[model samples]
Target chain A: MADKVLVFSRFAKSMLARFAEKFELLETGGKPANEVFSAAELADVRALLTMGAQPLGRETLDALPSLGAIVCYGTGYDGVDLDAAAERKIAIGNSPAANASAVADLAMTLLLGLMRRLLPADAYLRGGGWSGARPSPLLRPPRGLTNARVGVYGMGEIGRKIAARVAAFETDVAYHSRSRHDVPYRYVGSLGELVEWCDVLLIAVRAGPDTERIIDAAMLKRLGADGVLVNISRGSVIDQPALIAALADKTIAGAGLDVFEREPYAPDALSEFPNVVLTPHIGGHTLEAHVAMQDCVIANLAAFFAGKPLPYLVKR
Target chain B: MADKVLVFSRFAKSMLARFAEKFELLETGGKPANEVFSAAELADVRALLTMGAQPLGRETLDALPSLGAIVCYGTGYDGVDLDAAAERKIAIGNSPAANASAVADLAMTLLLGLMRRLLPADAYLRGGGWSGARPSPLLRPPRGLTNARVGVYGMGEIGRKIAARVAAFETDVAYHSRSRHDVPYRYVGSLGELVEWCDVLLIAVRAGPDTERIIDAAMLKRLGADGVLVNISRGSVIDQPALIAALADKTIAGAGLDVFEREPYAPDALSEFPNVVLTPHIGGHTLEAHVAMQDCVIANLAAFFAGKPLPYLVKR
Candidate 1:
């Protein structure tokens, strides 16, 4: 008999197959939290495997009386209330570095795509219009990363990886965090200052309540016209109305948004600008990343049953 | 006492303004062939400014008795037969290396835009749809330059610059050229084999009767599945009808096209594909590039007029 697991995750079927051999997997294919509650009416599950799509809240903990631990899929455990988990003395594990490369890749994708007006050219061609031949004269060589100031907010796994990629382009990489550390790049004391300094400001911080709407109109105005705003974090980090206004007024050169506030409901104003490059929120949904995350869930469960240290436990 | 310039060309006000301060400018925006034929009707004129857009054929050339040298603004001087100029010892010069970087940058823009599916996401968002939160699964990262086998068909200056850029991405760059000299990249013997070996085949060769339709139905098929095509050169280099069929049948992953056989007259089939990233013939239109080309023309003419060696001359 293997360790019984509760997998409350939503991913491609290909990712689910990674864990089939290891444990007695009880899975939900991206079902809502309420459905998971109904299904786990009384199942004595050893652990729960959860990711971004499913948040393991206090209610979820209350429902799962026999839950040994909650294995967080990606680096972000924003959905899981750590204080609540500490109160219960339940173990919480997460995979942080597993998807760092994937997220960094996505962030770069957004930065380049938005800055270069990638989508507008496509629209011009597909709409049977020959207008793309005559682009605005303002366009220059896709802004060589060399000698440009690039600011990264949040010096965590994704941010560090992004910094590494930025360095490859010969960019002057800088960051802003709680305290300044001795990194190769400049460590700004304040987020607002970093915004003012960087030609391109990339937000890779967490998307929790504390970080919600952190990049509002004031912060955006600080960036002004010379800046390009790229948001690869959660939608809540930016104020949508402010962003729309900034982009429309050319307060900033352009914006590349992969996530938005009230997702699946984009702002009407953003649609009008050709300068913005928008993508569905898929920062860590690459094939390699999804499989790695799923595999992480399986590894955590195996370690828990073996009475060993969890691979990546979130100690609140 | 002022320098007299014989303007036998159609000129934009922008170009005229650039040279107006220093030279005694003559503005013949569009004088006909027959009018230019009667050069005896004109007064003192020293320089002839010619463009392909207007007729400066044998009769017009012969009639311009007072013209000492012709300064053409474009890179291609197919209109004025150099033999006629050489016989009379009339110096001729055109802009060179003016737009290489700009064109190269545009090529990369198209390449990134097409491979990343930028337009589809934009279309969805602009059509009152939300795509950023729940992204369509990403295709490969344009087969990252790090490990890609890139084939360059024309190893000229633009091609060499492209090769250097691809090399920066850490790709194994190869090329097919006529009687290749020593270069850093591996030179493949044949275009057919180069297409087969490359994950992406780039065309940077010239477009003339000699190289017309070099990439036809059979050549595209050789690229096979998962391969891509990018044409920054003339559209006459590729068979449009064959390319349409290849793309329709998914013979290759996609293509990024900048030039066409006919300007502003791209086939509907090529532009319609979601996989294709199409741009009008504005590859070499960057401000920096245009100024550089103008400078190059000035330098070339300055050398010829000063009885010094010309920096770059077309070997005809």
Candidate 2:
């Protein structure tokens, strides 16, 4: 009999099909695992698959007496209580850097979309504003990408990728991170300095306690009226109300956001602004990224089942 | 005394303010020269300024007897009758490469926006589809830029710039042009071969007699169901009706079009497709590009007025 893997998060059936082929899956449909499965059924579950952002605490870990591995489906493993898991001798694994390129691609997409005023331009063309030759303030010439200052907040895989992509457009790239890495772009000592120095600030920092609400109103105001903000990082990196106020008062020129303060939920106040480009949290949602992540997930699960260390075991 | 310069196109007052300061302006507001100014008023119009896409044929040339120079405000000079001007010993000038970077930037913007399904993604977020956990087929994983085959249909400044931009995304870049240049990208023999070979075909070929309607139904069909087409070049290069049919039948996955068959007007049939991203001809409409082109225009006009060769004269 195959070792059963409990599904701790809601996932599309297609996404979960691969895991089903390799292991017996206990589908909880994002409900309490203990409620869905009897103690007898749960006692044999040795591994669990989850979305990295979904909460996996000590309480949930204790429920699965036999659970020895916690496999995060994406690069982020923020919600997993690492201390709790480690105390129980449960190994943690995550698909790191699998979605970096896709997320970086999205960061570029949103950045370009916002900077070029794509939404207004498309609407002007579609709404007969172009044909009627009506005055469109939004269609006016924008600050082109050539030689523009693009500062990246974070020097991680996604940030490095974003810097590389922007550099190709003839923009000068710089970054601010917790620590300096070997990269071509110039590094700024502080986030505030990076925001003040560049015309566009792209946030690709890892989400954690140190980064939560780091980009507050003061930082946004430092970004100035001509500056634009783009966030592919977690929404907690920015203060939602501060960003809204910044947009309202033109403290910053525009914003391109893939992640929001809340997943799948952005207020009308933010979306109502013509200068803001809003997207559902889909920074890592690409066919290539998904396949790459699944490969990591499969590899870790396979190794764990064979009485070996998880190939992609997370190091604290 | 300032030399009389006829403005043969409709332009914003702000755009023409600098020109007005240097010349005695004869604003025709894109009206016929004969209608706007009497022959006496037109006689001393030694130089003319025009939008590159507006037609300035033999009839218009004959009306301005002393029109020694025709300075185009942008890169293209297709609208001017070059042969007619040559026959009359009139010099032609254009701001060559002034808008190349801007146009290239917009091309990337459109391509990224289309392939990433930005419109549908934005709509899904705003329409509460995301919060509702509604199945968003449009938001499904897309084939990202990484390692994707990208074929450039032109090898001009704009095309070369585009190739450089996409290459940074880790895509395999190739090109098909009239003659192979010393570009870093691999060269393909023909447009058809390029279409069949690459996942995305970007049209950047210049508009001329031999190149008109080159990308027809057959070419689009060769691009295949998964292929995407992005045209930043003139609309005459693609058969608009054929493109419509191809889209209707799903011959191509999607398209990002900046120029169209008609100026300031697109057919409802073309605009109705969700897969297509349309922008009014604003590829070269950036402030930086405009300023650069204006500088070229000023230089050409100043040279002509001083009885010297146009500094930025057209070679042919």
Candidate 3:
């Protein structure tokens, strides 16, 4: 019999068909394992394929007696219980760097959109405000990206890509990571310092317990009246309430957000502000990134089934 | 007496006040010369400082008998009658390269915005589409800019700036200019060849008698269904009806337009298409560009009065 594998989330049907050739795929159809699969159905499962934010905890691991590996479809694996899998000697592999360019592109999109006030400007034009009196002053003139200081909060793959792209705009690029890398950009020690130094602060840090609410009211306050905040990382990295308050009080000039603390539920207050540009969490939702991520996931699963070392194993 | 100068258009009050120190300015308030000023008021006008597209013809030149110089506030001077100015030996100066960076920045904004489907995505998220059943696929997955071929229609200052910026995104850049420059990108002689070679065709050529309606139906059809078109140059550079038909028929994938043949009025047909991103002609509407343009205008006017060569004189 083929090695039984459980799919915890929906994937491309074509990709699943390819996987089916080598494995007896047991799909949960985006339902909970307990709700969709009985103990008997999960008992023979040798490996599990899941998405970045799919809940895979100790209880689910304990139920899957024969499961040896867990492969996540995207870079982020925050929802997976790393310690639980580690204790069981189960391999944890995630698709990393696959979505870097797409996320970086989104970061730039948000930054440029906010800086140019694209939303309000488009609205004004579409609403016939341009043909009316005082057309020149219909929208506030944008601040030029040329020579503007841009600070990347975390100099990871995505952040570095953003810095590289911003450099082409003739902007001054600086970054703040945990430690310094060999990159040419100026290194700031802390987030507060980065905030103070930059006209725009781009958040690209990894999310975890340590980074939860790292960018709070204090940092937002330091960002000042002319500063713009752009968050393409996990929403948990920022205190949403603090950001809302800051935007409400005009503490910062504006923001461009792709993530929210509550997924699919952007705050009504945020929508009310003309200075803010908001999008659903879609930083890495490009066709290229999706294909790359799926390929990475397949590679990791294949490697594990062949008793080879996982390609992108998460260190416990 | 201070040199009497007829202001053809309304300028910033601060700029007008600065000009007031040197010239006895007669303001027209953006009205017709005959309606705003008598022929007597224009008789002593020593120099004319106007915007690029202001209607200045042989008739207007005939009325301003003392007009020795014409200073355009922006780079484009298509509306000015150069032959008439040449016949009368009137010097013409324009603020060239003042808004290059700003225009290039907007071009990138439009390109990225269209590729990412930012407008509809934002609307979807704001309109509670995210809260619906399928949130992830709310917008069509965008193609990555990395390694994508970008063909620039013109290799001028703004176009070159755009190419430089696109390079940072890891895109392959090429150009189609009347004459090839010593730039790093490959040069395609014809617009058809350039369209076929690129995934995105960016139009940045100057609008003139020679270049009018350059991007017509056939050129767009050559761009193919997967190709995107971005226009940050003059609207007259494109045949609007052809573009609208191409968009309606899905001959091209999408478009990001900042200019239209008709000023301040986008066609009703364009608003119906979700694939296109539209903005009023605001590519150079930045605080930095505005200040630079005004300063350039001032410098040109100052040089003409000082009887030195105009800083940015256009060859008649």
Best by TM-score: 2
* Candidate 1 error regions (>4 Å): A1-9, A14-17, A20-31, A34-42, A72-75, A86-109, A125-190, A206-212, A288-316, B1-17, B23-98, B131-148, B154-157, B160-189, B206-211, B301-316
Instruction: Name the docking class for model 1.
Output: acceptable
> What TM-score would each prediction reach against the true structure?
0.81, 0.98, 0.95
Residues A17-89, candidate 2: write the lDDT tens digits: 7889999999999899888989889887899999988889999988898899999998999889989999999
In candidate 3, stretches whose alpha carbon ends up further than 4 angstroms from where it belongs are A10-24, A132-138, B1-3, B10-24, B134-139
Indicate the residue-level lDDT of A11 in model 1.
50
- Where does candidate 2 chain A have its weakest 10-residue lDDT segment? A132-141
The per-model lDDT (C-alpha) reads: 0.71, 0.90, 0.85
In model 3, what lDDT does residue A134 have? 42
> Could you give me the TM-score of model 2 versus the true structure?
0.98
Query: Which 10 consecutive residues of model 3 chain B have the lowest summed lDDT?
Result: B131-140
Give the per-residue lDDT digits (tens) of candidate 2, residues B84-153: 9999888989998999999999999999999888888888877888888887955458999888999999
Query: B1-316, model 1: which lDDT tens digit per residue?
Result: 4455666676556656656665666666667634653455443455666653233566656766655567776565555766777776677776765566556556666655655566775666667655443444343323433357889888876777667655554367899987595789998999999999998888888666677899988899999877888888888889988888999999988999987776557888887787888776656654555576667656755665566655656666
Give the range of the ten consecutive residues with the poorest summed lDDT in model 3 chain A. Answer: A131-140
The clash number for model 3 is 0
Query: What is the C-alpha local distance difference test score of candidate 3?
Result: 0.85
